[model samples]
Target: MAGKRSGSPDPKRHLWVLGLIAPMSALLPSQLVLYTKLEVFWWIGPIIVLIVIPVLDWVVGEDGTNPRDEDYELLSKDRYYRWCTYMFLPVQLSGLIIAAYMWSGDALSVVDKLGLAATLGFVSGIGINAAHELGHRVEHLERWLSKIALAQSAYGHFFVEHNKGHHARVATPEDPASARMGESLWEFLPRSVIGGFRSAIHIERERLKRKGHRWFSVHNHILQAWAMTAVLFGALLAIYGLRILPYLVLQAVIGAALLETVNYVEHYGLLRRRRPNGGWARCSPRDSWNSDRLVTNIFLFHLQRHSDHHANPGRRYQTLRTSEEAPQLPAGYATMIVLALFPPLWRIIMDPRLLEHYAGDVSQANIQPRKRERILAAYEYRAAA
Candidate 1:
């Protein structure tokens, strides 16, 4: 497929979108409170969002732009995304505060309270999400915001690894973060989490060696991240006491799970074939997922524009555009994540398409497969290799 042509970004549109961040962040705690109180309503948020949003988008349909313009330049060094990053600090902090309150109140049931805390924790993932965008930038303020965002999630090394490692080597077997074709979500999660962290350590170590410093020193982001996580956990313990420790851990786990779920969806079944020279093709927007669903796009700060992100890592979230040349998920990211929870269904739905796409390229002789068995065999060989 041909790549989509996008128009230059519009700053006004970016500001309009950035305006929504505060309200969304503010509303999340209240929504969690309601969910905790009602108990039954917890499922409602995911249901309504996962099901209804896509149906509505399908009915309304997207503008038929080959590569939909995201207007990334609008926020690309502009103050709008910076302002959003600044605004996000309070929003995430409020979530931590609310978790503390719930832990202290002792009025709510364990499940309900944990649910609320988990929701907030998931919201905290937005910190990493935002950082994922800003860390790619060259500016000092943006880089700082990126670190702050990652620090908030207790996943600070991602700021270094994602830009230095993942982007540089995505869609290749060498990249621990990339999901291989036909790999189940269950299989990918542990590998990605463990491998991603190790990659970060490796990247930081290389940087330290280059600078003639010890890898374990304060300058290393991995050690810094551990210290930051310790401080966060200490604060949680202080505010909520021992009773809330498990809940906080669970909340972080759930948030991490949510992040992994997103990773699964973003690059599920995508692959970069090896060239004759033993190098994978250069990463393209086509190697990642793409969605134009406006609602979740707004909530994710346009992260659904995965192709644009891979193509231009330094671009602010406000500007990530949609590209037609990129492979698209059949539905919005939220819905796709829900589907990914079912491994059989996910494989059945995705494997055939991937096989077809990979095999269709005649120029890529190594990717050719005469039949489905051949495709499966090829993957199995690669996995073992």
Candidate 2:
């Protein structure tokens, strides 16, 4: 075991969190039950991850405290924290391979197969989250492992765009990752999916061009990730046959959607005011939706404390601290993601929060231009009355 940071929480205090890692590795065993004639708990993956985890989050509640400022350097530098994420790479890989194997065998029901895909997708989605934390490091190996993890989502460009493109332009109209006020998730999905990929490519090409390298050069990060994904999926197809294609593509879509949903939530309706010089305000803790929900933070490497992530992009996840000044999410990411699927409820719940954050001034909110008039009319009219 790596030495604990001075004044760190007792190992006994948070040992339970270590158990949260099981689902990614457990998918095979759960699905294996479906393959057996004597049926057992085959639907465990989604149930544990989606249903049970939320209940646990509600029960365990939030932890708002930060590591002692003096301890941050030692804590963040702890190799033990990094190893937990490194171990997940194989866990994600094995889960997908077993999922493809199960999907090829035709033993599980359609619902279970979809359940299986969604389950793996969500788990693998966390791999991207892991990659996000690892990608931000100054370490070369960690950054490369970050890209390797992202290949599971087929969103390899994220390591490039999120760091170079999204961070620089976040909470502005020009940033595709920031969801405008009054934009539905359904609407934001296609726009984000397409625009995000294009943004990544644009950022990468500009970077390479600056370095005097052609866009088509072997050094392209997007090509590197895509090439690995192609070889991976090609191998899966050859081994598992055509059935794995739908499974592969569906899981990838679900994984990417998981990420976009986070992007949608993190800064929905938030704006960084433009300076007189035409530059946007420096990204701040106030610009993102933050949650101190303990369980989700433990599972996602403290990504729920996103306010700090945007403000301090180089900070490791374990040290992400909460601030009362930052806007709060209504719930953890899983519950919020479920809520975001319904446009009506999502607006009813989130719009008021956005309005409150801006003190009822809709003009300050990042309203989707298409819905700008209606949204402003509704809120502005209410504020006047």
lDDT of 1 at 95: 59
lDDT of 1 by residue, 19-89 (tens): 33422442464465465765643333343445655566567554323222443333355685567666776
* Among all candidates shown, the one with the greatest lDDT: 2
* Candidate 1 off by > 4 Å: 1-37, 41-75, 359-385
Candidate 2 global TM-score: 0.91
TM-score of each: 0.82, 0.91
Model 1: pairs clashing at backbone N, Cα or C within 3 Å: 9-71, 72-319
Question: What 10-residue stretch in candidate 1 is worst by lDDT?
Answer: 362-371
Measured on C-alpha atoms, candidate 2 has an lDDT of 0.80
